[model samples]
Target: MRIAVAGSTGLVGSQVVAVAKAAGHSVVGLAREDGVDLTSPVGLDERLAGVEALVDVTQSPTIDIEAVKFFETVAANLGDAATSAGVSRTVLLSIIGVDRVPQYDYYVAKVAQERTHRVHSPGLHVLRAAQFLDFPGMAIRWGRDGDTTTVDDLLSQPVAVGEIARVLVELATGERDDDVIELAGPRQERIVDLARRLVAHSGEHLTVIARDVPEPMRNGALLPGSGAIIAGPTFDEWLSRQPA
Candidate 1:
């Protein structure tokens, strides 16, 4: 199977490429360095020839108000090209809880992408994955000056990025199911505790203050439902394996 992965140099897409190759598939990397940009498909049709499927894991460069518009623009560019390429299947990575709530602008854009794929590619396999274990470090400054670090008591099931990439290859090549697949970590964790563990792993000191977070991110809202698949070396397990 010849699979082209957009954003092939990114955190998720890179892993998808490695996994796809490990699973005995030829990969076409769709990135600027690869001489192909999905945002402007000038010669994309020529490149996508004989490609079976495409996995879109392109991410917004920023985490601000403008990211919503940026996401929509990127999705439109890639979705239209993928549909035109006559690919058999298309897989897109999405977030959990965004489809129903759409509380954040970025979340709304994700839903829009899924909807567009639904109309364009009938065999769109949507993988609504949970937050990544590496997300905590990116969330806030925790132990910069060895002081009390404040964090939300938001509960979430975060999976390893490598694990998510593994499943993406499975979905992209295994079958052409159009249904949404929910994926999450095996155990649920709170932000404060997760922060504390992360700091400890780095041999740092900081008092963790767990404050109340907003709705739809608390309790079991971010956890996967009964039918959702649970795949992991768990969050704590994954953290322990990280380099100090």
Candidate 2:
């Protein structure tokens, strides 16, 4: 199969590309680094040529109206280009609870992306997964620098990025059921605990204060529901592999 992965350089997309190649599939990478901007579709038609499937794992850091517009544009461009290229299936990586709860601008953008694919490309497969275990590290780095606060009480099930990538490849090679598949980590842990574990793994001491994070930033919806697929290595297992 000829697979084209958008945002192939991102944390998750990069893994997807690796997994696809390891599975014996021909993979093409499309990203700004690869001279294909998904938001504009400037070189999409040429890049998507001979692509049997497209996995969209693109991301942007916009907020408010800008975020929504960015995803909407990317979705439109990808859908059109994939259709023109005779792509049979389109797979999208989405966050869990995008439609269940009222999240910030980014969630709205995700909803728009999903809707665009549904209407424009009916053969789309949407996979929703929980937050990555490394997400708390990102949050802490983006937050303050002190070691006084610990945020171990917030609920989250952090899945490994590699596991998510493998599942995506599985979906890519299978039929597109046009249904949403939900995946999560093997165990549930508080955000603070996860953060602390991550910090400890880095051989650093940092306090993760759990405050009333803004609703847009809170990942309450990332938790798995009853009977939802709980896949991938546990957080502690993944943490143990981190370099100190």
Candidate 3:
């Protein structure tokens, strides 16, 4: 099968491309680095020519209305071009808690993205995934203020990015009855705790503090349902491999 991956160099998309290619599939990379921008994209149909499956793992750099516009445009562009190119399968990567966090701007944007895809690509399959295991590191880096780092006191089932990528590739080529699938890590964990552990592991002279967030996230809104597929390198297992 020939697969085209949008955001082909991103965290998850890159992995998806690697997995597909390693399995002996041909790949067409659609990304800005390759002179293909999904938003205001040119020659998208040409790029997707002969692509049997397409995986959208594109990301927005912002979280406000701008983010909403970014996703909406990208989804629409990809859907139309894929349809024109006769792509058989389309898979979109989404966050697990997007529907649960109605008030959050980024979540709202994601919902809009999904809505656009559903409209333009009727056969789209969405893979809603839990927070990535490396999220704690990102949080700490973003929350840094002097020697203190503040993180949301949120519950999360942090799945490995590689595992998420593997499943996405499978969905692109395999048959499934459902339009949506949820995936998560093996265990539930606190984001703040993970941040503290990460700080300790890195020997960083920083204080990790847990701050309050909305009740939904603090409670369990981001968790996957019983039907969700669980995959690993549990957080600790993934962390152990990180260099100090």
Top candidate by lDDT:
3
Off by over 4 Å in 3: 175-177
Tell me which residue pairs clash in candidate 3.
Answer: none
* Candidate 3 per-residue C-alpha lDDT over 70-147 given as tens digits, one digit per residue, 9 for 90 to 100: 999999999999899899888999998889988778888999999999988636899999999989999998889999
Give per-candidate clash totals: 0, 8, 0
- lDDT for predicted candidate 3 compared with the true structure: 0.91
Over the stretch 40-127, how does candidate 1's per-residue lDDT look in tens digits? 7577767777888888898877654577766666666666677677787888999878765556566767777777677766268889
Could you tell me the C-alpha RMSD of candidate 1 in Å?
2.5
lDDT of each: 0.77, 0.79, 0.91
Model 1 regions lying over 4 Å from their true place: 141-152, 176-178, 206-212
Q: Mark the regions of model 2 whose C-alpha exceeds 4 Å error after superposition.
A: 63-65, 146-154, 175-178, 214-220
Give the C-alpha miss distance for residue 56 in model 1, angstroms: 0.7
Indicate the TM-score of model 1.
0.88
RMSD of 3: 1.2
